[model samples]
Structures are given as C-alpha cells and as structure tokens.
Target: MSQITRIKGSHRAASLVIAGSAVTTSGLVATAEDAVDIRAQTRSVLSQAEALFSRAGLRKSDITRVQIWLADMADFPAMNEIYDAWVDPEHAPVRACVGAALANKHYLIEIQVYGYQPD
Candidate 1:
C-alpha cells in the first residue's frame, strides 16, 4: 500500500493530502483584498490551488477534477472567465461549480483541486 502524505497549513486541517498517485487539496479561499471582486477572488483561489499542486509535484494539466463554490450564483460567469483563461483547454479537468454560503462572508469563492501524480 502506498503511504499517505499530508501537507499542513496554519489552519486546523491538512492543506493537501497525497495517497498513492492521487493528490487532493483542502478548500482554498481568496485573499481578503480580492474577496469583494468575483473575478479577483476566483483568480486568487485558482492561484492558491496552483501553488498547492506545485507542492505536490503536479501541474494544472495534471488536475483531474475541480470543485468550486460561490457565495452567490450571480458570480458564476465572472468566475468562469478567470477559470477559462487559467485552465488548459486540451487538458481541462472535470469541474463542478455551485452557489453556496462560504465559511467566511468575505470569501466570495472557494476552490478544491484533485489531481494525479504521473508515474
């Protein structure tokens, strides 16, 4: 069996977990400064996800799935605009976006990423 590795952050939960060839990240939120703008919040969240992927030795292309949560449905289009530009069209991962209340009112968006590490 492959050992599970966890990368922890200052928060109570692990930031990223790696088991076998799979890598998963905890929900990533936008910075306080970007929280007011959907586009900026989306960009901030994705950038944080990218940083986590890099730590796991994975890239955006390696992502297999993505889960996104928006504080308001009205922000969907704005979020997609940034997401569309950041994701590789040829390697786009399966994704789901939905409107829901975030942990913090200031967080306009949150993103979770899942990917596979190549052998």
Candidate 2:
C-alpha cells in the first residue's frame, strides 16, 4: 500500500492526502475565525485550497478534479465567481458542485482538489 501523507492546514483537520505523486484533499472550508457571509466564505475556502496545493508541491494547473459543496445552490454563482478567478480556465479540470450540508453552519462553501505531480 502506498503510504498516505496528510497536508495539514492552519485548521485542525489533516485532510490533504498524498501517495506517490498524487495529491488529494478533503473538503476545505473557510479559514476565517469569525463567521463570514457566503461570498466571503467562498473566497476563504479557495484561498485555503490554494495554500494546500502549494504545500503539496502542486499548482492549480496540476489539478485533475475538483469537488465543491455548497450549503445553498444559490451560492453557486458566488462560489464560481471566486473559483473562476483562482483556477486556470485554459487548463481547467473536471469539476462538480452540489448543494449539501457542511460540517459547520458558518461555512458556506467547501472544496476538495486532486492533482498529480510529474515523476
């Protein structure tokens, strides 16, 4: 079995997983200590995901798949607005966004990313 490595964020969860050159993370929510509105929370989640990518020696362009969970479908536009700004449109990966209950009510968005590093 490939050893799984966890890339921990400033938050308590050690969610990011690494095996071989592949990297994947669990749903990451807003990093703001205080409760934030949907727009702000969405941005925060993306920022945190970016940080994780950096830690894993991966770039947004390396992402192969992206999964997003929103507390409300209405937040789609808001989440994509920030996400579109963060990801490279020319090399965009497969993605899915759906409305679902999150770990925290304060969280408006959560994202998981998977990427592979060239050997």
Candidate 3:
C-alpha cells in the first residue's frame, strides 16, 4: 500500500488527497466575489477543482465522479449553465447535484471530485 499524500490550499481535513493513482478532494466552494453569484460561484468551484486535478497531474477529463451541493435548488439552472460548458461531453464525469444548506451561507454551490490516472 502507498502512503497518502496531501494537496495544499484547501481547508483542513477536506483538502485534496492523493495515494497511488487516485485523487480525492474535500468539497470545493467559492470565495471572494464568486460566492454570492450562482454562475461565478459554480465557475470558481470548478476552477478550484481543476487546480487540484492539475496538482495531481491530471485533467478535468480524469475525473470519474463528482457530487455537487447547492444552497438553493432554484440556482440549479444557473449552475448547470456553467457546468455543462465546463465538462467535456465525451469524458463527462458521473455527477449528482442536490440542494442543501452549505457550510457558508454565502456559498451557492460546493463540489467534490474523484479522479484517477492509470499506471
């Protein structure tokens, strides 16, 4: 078994972690100007996720699954507008999105990603 390694730049415990060929991240949320705006927030979250994937030497296409949490279900359409554009149709990850209260009231959406690389 391989020792787990950590990815910096996220909150404690929920930061990105990698062991062997797989990469896992704590739920990603928006910050600064992005948090309150549904579109910006969704974009910020994906950008954060992309940065994590890059840190793991992977790409958005590498992600196999994702779970999205939305603070308001009414924001779903707006969030999807950004998400549908960000993900590649051919390699789109299996995904789930649900409305829920988030850790931060300002956060409109949160995302967690799972990705893999073949040895």
Write the candidate numbers in order of decreasing lDDT. Answer: 1, 3, 2
lDDT of each: 0.90, 0.80, 0.87
Q: Which RMSD values do the candidates have, in order?
A: 1.0, 2.3, 1.4
Better model by TM-score, 1 or 2? Answer: 1
lDDT by residue for model 2 (45-68), tens:
777777788887778888899998
Clashing residue pairs, candidate 1? none
Q: Against the true structure, what is each candidate's TM-score?
A: 0.95, 0.86, 0.92
lDDT of 1 at 15: 87
| CA displacement after TM-score superposition, residue 88 of candidate 3 (Å) | 0.6
The parts of candidate 2 lying over 4 Å away from their true place are: 1-3, 9-13
Q: Which portions of model 1 show Cα errors greater than 4 Å?
A: none
Candidate 3 on 1-119: residue-level lDDT in tens?
A: 88788877544574788887888889888887776589999889999899888877888889999999998899989989999999999999999998898887788888999988767
| lDDT digits (tens) for residues 4-110 of candidate 1 | 99999666889899999999999999877776699998888899999988988888999999999989999888889899999999999999998898888888888
lDDT of 3: 0.87
**Which runs of model 3 end up more than 4 angstroms from their true locations?**
none
Error of 3 at 46 (Å): 0.3
- Cα shift from native, residue 85, model 1 (Å): 0.4
